[model samples]
Structure formats: structure tokens, C-alpha cells
Target: MTQHFTAPDRLTAKTGTQWWRDAVIYQVYPRSFADGNGDGMGDLEGVRARLPYLRDLGVDAVWLSPFYASPQADAGYDVADYRAIDPMFGTLHDADALIRDAHELGLRIIVDLVPNHSSDQHEWFKRALAEGPGSPLRARYHFRPGKGESGELPPNDWESIFGGPAWTRTADGQWYLHLFAPEQPDLNWDHPAVADEFRSILRFWLDMGVDGFRIDVAHGLVKAAGLPDIGGHDQLKLLGADVMPFFDQDGVHAIYRSWRTILDEYDGERIAVAEAWTPTVERTANYVRPDELHQAFNFQYLGAPWDAAALREVIDVSLAAMRPVGAPATWVLSNHDVTRHATRFANPSGLGTQLRTPGDRELGLRRARAATLLMLALPGSAYVYQGEELGLPDVTDLPDEVRQDPSFFRAAGQDGFRDGCRVPIPWTVEGSSYGFGSGGSWLPQPESWGKLSVEAQSGDPDSTLELYRRAIAARRAHPGLGAGSDVRWLDAPEGVLAFARDGFVCTVNLTGRLVSLPLPGRALLASGPFTVDGDRFELPGDTTVWWTV
Candidate 1:
């Protein structure tokens, strides 16, 4: 791969008591990030080609979604081989090169590690199937005997998170559990071999110079003592809102404690981040309790509405929970699994029943820009999802025929269906795939996306991409931005959120009408134009401004 930009090794800077506390990490969904080799699918080479871009964007790290060897049953979440890279994404050499390239650009790399389940095509699962019931190989997974007069019924009433029954009967009459798609079998975390195997996998990547890992389904690694029934319908929909027997069980903490030891063993402050969906912020804090993982993604914040009251409540609760555990609160607005915040904010209610509509994009972009500034100004690390910096809205108009998300066909109700946010991002304004690749993209880019391409927004100061670049740069330069742990809630009007951290203050106006708010210091950044009169500034509706006190 041709090198774009290089810098002296800065991995050592990542060391310190809590480097992750206020870090601005960028999430790169590999399949949609960029494509290399004209295959229409993003590869490690594509990521390598874009390292300079991420570096210039001023993010502390790049958290890559899964690109491991898989059946693509769930878009690489189903891992067939933990150590090898899928041919579509490139070889192991490409992965190593990407890691090396990222480090040289002063950017850390965090790859996804899925331990909750493995693709049925995995050698271990294949062996378990060939060996049949009562085989020792089956001990590595959640294999069990069927329950019924003729063993025709499922082992339990537990439903798959993706829909349907969780247990699938093999040709041998035995049943295995899969919380997701049947192709992705849940692993038996109780087994020592499972733990040992994962530890070995962690070491393999760590040895290859990876900075850290984003543990997929981090909370589901350990299920309840017995394979218990959920005993209710739509159990998947209750995830993160209510506790289920299969999720957020106390048993998972033990596994993380052990993994934390392995991470601490490596230099460069190797870390583990949990993609956990707990019932409460306190439960989420359990995953990052100093001895466990280093950070846990705060989905509550991501799900919060644009209303000031809701956003402030979530922020206060999140900070309060993490403070006790001595873990930094992590904030994220969007990811590959959910609706993009730009489109989400456009709807006054936040989540939409239908798809995007007229007047939605304008309102959404305004709120999204305000929300991005608000999230970045908060005291903690923030995650920037790919394409979000370019103000990409969710592709809600995607035809059902081209849908690839497993949840689209399986899960009913309001859960799943993540394909809209996973569309390939536009690079150049004019190309078959908007310069995403030389060939047709896996998912079609919207015709209007040409106006939102990186090339079009690169130099525009008012553009979302430039706003993100400035916000990140300011965060890196300002001592009070990313390193602080708590924000002192400043008294403000009912429809505004005002908080001061260290010597900096941020005020966001969420009200429909304009409001005048006192500024503590010189203006550092503002989401939009504001009127200043004396010590008070007129804050426009859905605007955020940062001031250096």
C-alpha cells in the first residue's frame, strides 16, 4: 500500500492512567468505510489507504468493526476463524500492515472481537456437529439434548434475538442454542477451553501490534446457570431497557476480570471495550470497573432524545455511574447497528415508524450538528461513526430486495433491521459507487449523497466534515475537553443545557425559540451563527457553543 502520511510513533502517548477517558475514537465499519481492489467491498487495504484521512481528522483511535473470516451471514459478526482475515477483506498480512500504518499515523487501532458466538462453519463447530451428541467437541458450545416425547420440541421457549426459536436441531437430533442467527452458535463460556481459546486469540492480535479490541456482545458472553426459558414473547425488544435471564447476568463479570488480566499483561496499555447493553447505567458501569474492561459504550446516551431534559438526565446518570467505578464515560451518537442520528434527530419523537420524509433532512441536519457539538463538549470519550462526520443520514428508502441485514427478514417489531445505517459512504461526487469502490457497492448510495461527498465538503467550513475536524482538533488542543471527568451543571433556562468543565463551558439550546445565555469565556466554537450582546449571547434553537473560560 502506498503511504499517504507518516509520523513518529505515538503509541506510547496512549499509555497513562486513563487514556481512554476522554479519547475521541472513530468507528470504521469496514464494508462501508472504503473499498480497495475494485471489489465493491471494503478491505484492510482500503482502511490503510484512508489512514491519513483518519489521522488528519484528529481522532485518537480508529475502532474497526469486524472484518474477520466469516460466512457473512450477519455481515462478519459470525466468525468462522478468529485468527484469519476473510479473503474479501484481504489477508492477515493486510491486517498487520493496517495496524502498522495506523500506528505510524499516530492513531490507535481497535478491532472487533466477537466471543458471544461463532459461525457454524467454524472448524470447532463443524467438529462438534460431526462428533454428534455427547461428543467432547460439543462441550465447547451450548449443545443439549432435545426435550419432548420424541425430542421434537426445542430445548426451551427462549426466542432468538433475531427472531424465531433460539435452539436449532441438527441432523443428529441434538439441539444447539443461538441467540442470533442459527449460523452463529453461542459459545459455552463456562468451559475452560472457551476461555483459554479467546485469551489465545487476544494474544495473537496483541502480538500483531493491535492496540485494543471492541468486544462484541460483551454482556452475552456468559448466560444464566441453566439454559432457562425467557417465558415471554418479544424478549429481544426488551434488551437494554429491561433485564433478561440471558443478558446482564452477574456471571459475565468474572470472564471480563480474567480478560482484563490478559490485556494488562501487554504493553502500550492494551485495552478492552465492551459493547454491552445493560438495563441501567450502573449495570453498564460494571463492565468497566477498573478490573474489568477499560470502557463500555453508553447506548443510553445514544438513544436519548434531542430534548434538553432527556439528554441532561442521561448525561448526569452516565457520569454518576462511571465516576464510582473510576471508568470514563463513553459517549456515542450512531453506529452500524442503529439509525443514524442525523435522520433520528429530524423526527421530533427521535425514532421514526416509517422512513425519511420531506422537511426531515433539514431539521435532522440542524439537530445532528447541534448534537455532535454537544456530545463532543461533554466530559468523556466520544465515538464518531463512519459517514456521520459527512452528515450522512440513514438510507431509510433502501429497497427490501437489496437488504442484507439478518434482522430485516428475521426480527419482527421495532428491533433489528440495521442495513440503512450500513450503506457504503460516498467519497467523490461522481462515480458508480460515489467513489466508494471501482465496482457496484453492496448497498446502493442515495442519488442525493453526491452533494454530501467528502470531496464536496472537504474545504467548506460550514460543512459537517469540517465541523467534525474542528471539533476534534479543538478537543485535542484544549486541556479541558477530553481529559476532564465531570461537568459542573451550570444553571440555565429550562430548554437549554449548560455545563462547565475545568475552565471551559458548553451551552446547547434545544428549545424551539431562541434564548439568551451567559457566556463564561471567549468563544472557541459554535455550531451555528449566534448573536452576542454584552456578557450574554443569544443562542438559537438547536445550537451548541463552546467557550474557553
Candidate 2:
């Protein structure tokens, strides 16, 4: 019933290197993308078929979320086979073919590597459960003898991210640890077999023509040696302690150093982006040194407020955190985990509102256009989520019954599922569901997205798709925006956030009121170009203007 997964016939498929500096990475959620073979879920062949579309979008790289073998407990995060692709998504041949296809279309492919844990049903875990302490596989995971009533007193007070006891009682009155869900058991990194197995997994994919990997939960690999109880945060959760001591241990860095050696064998060009959510910039930089990982996302920017003051603080924190490491910085305003920018930043009343009216849609289109400039204008490379380039807002009203993501489910009675933004993409304009597939989707389609399909907006010059194209072209044309690491915060009288790079200053009117700012030099870029004069530049509503020199 299983097919063999041999490493790709070709490993060095890419001729050119050092493509990360100015690259724009487009992230794809495989489940919500195009579904091939008439399956409701997206698969590898479907991603291969869409390579041309990504190439046309002018993105340099495409990061495919986990396609590895899974039980779909955590939507592929609970990997059952690290070396093979999930049968639901596709076969090994599809992965090999996908790499070649993506390369042919001038795109780099990065797959998610979930190293933190594995599905309880994984082979090793099954062996551990069957043989108990006598099994060689018992050491692969964290299993301990029980104490108190039904193993109620866990080794530690650390709570699972899913909101319950991190330890689960086994049939023999022992507790097995899982930082996420009971279905996913935490692996023992100190175990030699675990490290060797992970390295072997890396070699399997790297040899398979895959470009690189995006490591999931990079910091959560190694826990405290004795598995001590967490001590704080009682007021917040009425549960697990704030256990700071158990995380980011010194031994974790040693594991990363070893992984760097595997990457080194392939000429060290294969990039690894860490999903390291360590709050402080200084602590997060440990995973992104010259050897550990090529880059690590600083989530400070993702969770920052929409206003200027908070954003500026995040910018400062990021720069300050990375100043010592000498690694390139990365930035993004949105991702798969959080609320969509449209609902979070635009709506004051919250998620349930009439914000999808025709007028609201037009206004959102304009703000999205302006946000494009700001995203690209920042110091580092930008990550644009799927359909974000087309200004797709979170419109799908997800019913509580169909929620999928595990993070929201663990939130105890809270409607924590983020399936609202994970709705299927619209490929055609003939129907309300936009012909994503032959039948109903895993998510209910928003009526508002009927007119926003790629098919309908492809040739429209004023469409957000065209605006993204123009904005990307402009950012590339003037390298100063991406270059010139130094930024000078410019002072403006009104509620404006202004900055200068490479002798060029850009001022934005974040508020609805009209305002003007005097430019010392001639015009290079303007919000609504023809509307400006020689001295003072008048900015229309929620627009940002950039300069060349």
C-alpha cells in the first residue's frame, strides 16, 4: 500500500545562487489551492500545474506548507512520514516532478519541515506504546511513570498550546508529553536516534530536487532536561505556568549547529526559514546565524498594531535585535495564523459588520494598493500570502462546525479557528464559489468574492492584481527602497508616518483628512501622481508615496 520515496534524481537543479537578497516569497496553503484529480483538497500536481501562475505573479519563491505524509490531525503538521509525501496530497514522483516544474518556471520551492513533534500514530510512537519501557522506540518520545490520581501530577505544569494538560495518561498509569495536542506527542531531541532520523529525513528531501526547507517550531525542539513545572501566567489561563525556563535551552543551539552541517554538504545555498516566535529580537537571532538558518521571521511585525507608533516600535525592535547577528531582516504584515488585515485593521466594530459593501470594497482596494507600497518599502524582503497580491480579504463566514486548525480548537469555547481566511481561492467568475472545484468546498465561499477572481481581474489595469504588478515593478526599478539599510524617520505635522531612504523621503497620510508636505526635491513617486504640485505634495486618503532620489 506504500510507494518508495527516493531522493530526487537531481539535487543541483538551480544554476544561479544568492537569489534570497531581493526575493519575494509567495506562501501557498496547499489545502485551499487548486485541487487536482477531482479531489476537494489541493495536492502536489495541482501546485505543479499552477507554477506558471506564480511565475507570472513575479514572485521569486513559493513556500508550500507541509505536504509530507500525515494523518491530517493538525492539517499535515503531524507528520507520519518525513521522507514521503502524504498520499492525500500526492506521491513521491509528484514531488520530484514538482521541483523540476517549479525550476522550469523560475521559482524556488520550500516545503515546511515539522521537526517539533510527530503524529502519535507514527511508526516509532506505535512501537513505544506497544513495548513500553522495554522497546527501543520508547526512548524516541517523552514517556514517564505516573504519580497521584490517574497521573494527574504531570512531570511539569507546562500546558499544551492546545489548552489542556501537556501530559496524557497512558493505560499503565504513565504520562506521555505533547506540547500541542494529545494526538501529537513531543519527540525526545536528546535521543541520538531522533537527531539521526531527522538528519536522514533532511537528506531524503534535499536529494529529491527540493530547493530548501522552512522549519516549523524551530525553537520548540528541545525542552528542559528534567521537564520541570512552569511557574507563572496563572492569572491569564487559570492553567499552565508561565514556564520560561523550559524553553530556548542552551542545548537547542547544539542541535541547530549539527543541522547546519547537512545544509553545508549542498554548498550551503539551500535556505532555511525558521518559524521561531521568540519575542525578543536578540533571542530569536540565535536560530539565524550564518550556519543555523538562512533567515527567521520576526513575528513582532506581524502582531503589531495598524497605527504608526506601534509599528515604529516593532521596526525598531527588529533592527535592534538583529544588529549584532549581522543577518538580513525579514518583514510581513500578514500570515496564516492571525486574523486577515481587512478584518483586523480596517473594521473598528469587529468581524461582524457590513464592511463588504461595494463602497467598502472600493475603499479596501485603495488601502490595499497603498499597503502594497508600504510592505515593499520596508528594509527587508516581504512575504505576501496567497491571494494577498490580489487584495483578497477574509470574507468567508465560517460555521463553528467546520473549523479545522488545531490552534483555535484548543482555545476552550473561544471561536479560535482561523478558517475564515483559509477559504478556497476563486479561479473562475461564473459562480459564487468561483469554480474552485467541482463540488462544495471545505469552507463556505463569501458572496463578496464573486467579482474578485483571477480570471476576471487578469487584464483589468485598475485591479489590485495589476497594482501589485506595477508596485513590484516599481520597487525593482528603484532599488533604493529594498536597499539602503539606513532609514531616517521624518517628522510631519499631521498624523503621518514618514521616512527617508537613499536621499529619498516618503510621507503617508494614514488618516482620512487631506494633508500636504513640502518636498525639498523634484517628484519621483506620488500617491496620485498628477494631483501634486512642485513644493507641497497633497496626499489623498490612506495613500503612501515613495521617492527615487
Candidate 3:
């Protein structure tokens, strides 16, 4: 027989170093977050202007997507120069000012570091292309002779994550590998010069006083030996869930170990968080080993089906995996790449293959609120994607002509178009572009977003924004929330999840019918209001409540 948990008077230990252990970090997609210069794109100045807002929101840090010098091939993920700021975003001085402003507000800044590849227009890639096929410059990238008699075919049969063949032939008649878009070339990390250059890049940013780096494609830096062929199709479909030759290799750990040493040299406990996609939760944890990274995003939790048992299993596995590494499990529900959880959770089918099924938006918003409250109640750090607090739904009906994601254009096998999630956020209900900036937004926002605008919901107690604010405030004040990693499971009926974290008891009802239960203590916060019937309470479906013991 299994033991059930009760409201406890005492709490468990909350141990970890640095602020990231129980911190709440908000992810800002710079191009869509705000437009500071009225240039139709979010820039460093925009981020600087919004520092106070983030501070008021009670976030410990801000993880910015790439704003480095780039051609915007993959929305800044294809870095042309790691040291310089893109003209479209802002000047280098603006970045400095933003960092200073964020730090002053007690909000740490984490920038994206794209280590796996670089823009084709980058100096190194240009030199490799100009120096001809066998030149020493070619050794910095994956350049190889063709396989066919006329050397016409690619050297390997690897598929790009974006879609299509991974190999592209240059004017010099040699094939170069790019795991994503053809305009982005994969770097050869085995070269000593490549490693040294990236180390210097890290130092350059660290010296600039930025708090940390979010390493993109952190697990794909080192490829499998001999560049073996996957020998199968639809490789991109297997990302994050299945093992592939190009990702989650053992050699990637060595590179992270070296980077960890550099982070330790900094004074402000600067950290490195990995956007790694591994086959399993335990495998992803390896990136955050004692001598490696500080944190690894729990993708398993992000992709888990919206079910009680599935979520419980993922939470358990995530916690178990991180226990040995002594690293905090980073929880993320949505990001720039994936569809917003509001729309995703609303769908009857939660799988990636069917992300765009028309579903009940009302039901989705309710479940999203409940899910967010549940995630915030758990131990370790949590990440709130930009606009999630506003309860923005994915813009699934964007015109095909304006869609920008490479995967969307490739028309290959993928979950859905990513542009739906990257629409510029609405700040006000009256202005064009919804006050994202003075100018037009880069991507069109839904006209119906007025009801969800910050201005519209700012004063409403029932708004999703207010709920997030209250939840975050409660997490900070309550000793029970966001403190310990241990969770005491309580016996509950099917379609219900009940757990005790320290002195707090969180109960979530996922079933259709209302369930009556005894109150453990006074209610601190709840996703939805429940009816109280004497000593017992009526918990409505799709609601989560936090009670202090």
C-alpha cells in the first residue's frame, strides 16, 4: 500500500548555490518583445525601457534570444559576428546600457550563444569559400569531396534539421555541411582554433558584465565520429525525443566542462544554461553535471501530454535526473520556437504532429492557467515565455505569404508553423501594432488581441496577467513555494493531482466533475476560485489551488 501525504507543519531543505536555484526567468524574443526605436523590430533600447516592467513582474532574470550581428537567416540564430550587435537590433552601446539597466533593476541578463553554426556571410565561412576546396581554411568547417564518380552527390546522407539535405555544394565544387538552413554553416568544433575562438567569445561577453549565456544547440556541438549517415528519413521529426547521430554525443560534455571553468572565473556567479535536446531526461541532465552547465531546460516537461499521469511522470523523472547532478531542473512551457501553450494545451491532440487542430480556446486558457500554477508550485527554477502571462494564443491563421520560419517554407514534415508563436506582443488596445512600438510591428498581431492587451488587463483581478503576478508574489513570500525539490504525493482520484511541497499543499482537478475535499489550510492563491461548503471545498474542473499548512 502507498502512503498518502497530509498538510505538514515543517518544510524540506532548499539547497543550491547562486540565484538560479529557485529563480523565475522570463524569455524575451528581442525582435518581438518591443520596438524601442520605432523601427518595427525590438532592440536593445526596447529591452532597456522594459527593465522596470520585468522587475515589477518579479522575475529574477531575462533570457534574451539572439540579437547579435546576423543576416536574419534564421531570426538571428545564424550569427555573423558574435561580438557585434546587429544594426537592425541596435548599437553595441545600446546593449551595454540595457545590461546596466537590467542589472540595476536586480534582473540578471542571459543572452543567446549560437555555437553550433554561423551565418554563411561570417568572415570565417567567407574565407573558407574563397580559399577553394582543399585550403586549410576549409578545415574549420565540414568540407568534403563528393561521393559520386563526378563528385556530384553529397558525402553523407544526413538530413538538415530545417529540412532537405544537410550538404550544400559551394562554387568551388566541394560540399559543406549545414545541419539547418543552407545559409547557416556548421562549424568544426574538433579544430583547436574553433574552440579557442569560442572561449574568447565567452570571455568577451563575460567581461561586458552580462549575467549568463543561453547556449543554443548545446548538445550538437560535437557530432558522432566519421560523420555517419543516419540512413533514414524524417530526421528532424525525431528531435528531442529520439537519438540521432548529430546530437547528444558524449564529446559535447568535454566542451561544456571547459566552459564551466570559465563561468566559475566570473564574480557574479555567472551561469550557462543549455538549450539541449537529448533522448532522455537523464541524458539531458549530463549537460548540467557538477563540472558542466548550471542548468538544462526540461524539454520533456515542455512536450509532455496534458494529462495528469504524463505530467507526474515527467516531473518525477526530471527531478530524479537532476538530483545526482545537483543542478536545478529548469521548467519551460513555451518558447519562441514552439507553439504557445495556450493553443497547444487547448487542442484535443497534444502531440506536435497535430499542433494546429481547431480546439476550444476557452478551455485552453483555463487549462493553461492551471498548468502554470502547477509548474510554479514545484521546486527549482521556472521560465515564463514572453507574452505567456498575457495568455496570448498562437496566431495560427497567419497568411502563407508572410510566414518566415524555414521549416514552414520547407513544407516538409514538421509540427506546425512557428510564426504563429512569434507575433509581436500587444501592449495596448488602442494603438496600431498594439503599442509594441511607435511603428508597425515586424510580424502582424491579431486584431482580436485588444482584449488581452496589457492595458486592457492591467487592473483586472481575473486577468491572466494578474494571476501570474499574484502567483509569483506568493512564491516569493511563501516559504513553501519555490523552495525545495522534494514533493510528497497525495492519494487522489483519477484525473486529479495532489502534492505537498514543504508546508504548501497544491491540488489540481483535471476531471470534468467537481470534487469536494477538506481544506488543508487557508488558501494563499488559486488558478480559479472554488466554492466552500462548510469544512469542505468544491474544486471545479481545470482549477489549481495552493493552500498553506
Predictions in order: lDDT: 0.87, 0.71, 0.86
> Candidate 2's residue-wise lDDT over 1-549, tens digit each?
112232222223323445565567888988887777556777787788888988778777889998888888888889888888899789999988888788666677888998889998899998789887667787888888766665567767677767777789877666888878788998999899999998888887777756678888887888877876657555224311222544566677788888878876774266778887674767788887776877788676766554667667777777666656766677875667655565555654234222232225555555656666776777767788887766787754566687787766675422455676678888778753576666556677776565788887898876777767766666666756664345688888656778877756666666766777776455555434335576666777678777755
TM-score of each: 0.96, 0.89, 0.96
Tens digits of lDDT, candidate 1, 1-549: 112233345655656656677889999999998998889898888889999999989998999999999989999999999999999999999998999888888888899999999999999999999988888989999988889898999988888878888899999898999989999999999999999999889988888878789999998988887878876656766777787777888999999999888888776777899999999999999999979999999999988888989999999999999999988899999998888888888886755423444337887898899999999988888999999999998887788899998877884633554888889999898987988889879988889988999899999999999999999999888888887678898899998999988778999999968998776789999888898999888989999999999
Per-residue accuracy of model 3 over 210-320 as CA lDDT, tens digit each: 878999999998888889987665676677777777899899999999999998887667899999989899999999999999999998899887788988999999999
The better-scoring model by TM-score among 1 and 3 is: 1
- Tell me the lDDT of model 3 at 474: 92
Candidate 2 — which residues are off by over 4 angstroms? 1-17, 235-243, 349-366, 411-415, 520-530
As for lDDT, the candidate ahead, 1 or 3, is 1
- Order of quality (lDDT): 1, 3, 2
- What TM-score does model 1 achieve against the real structure? 0.96
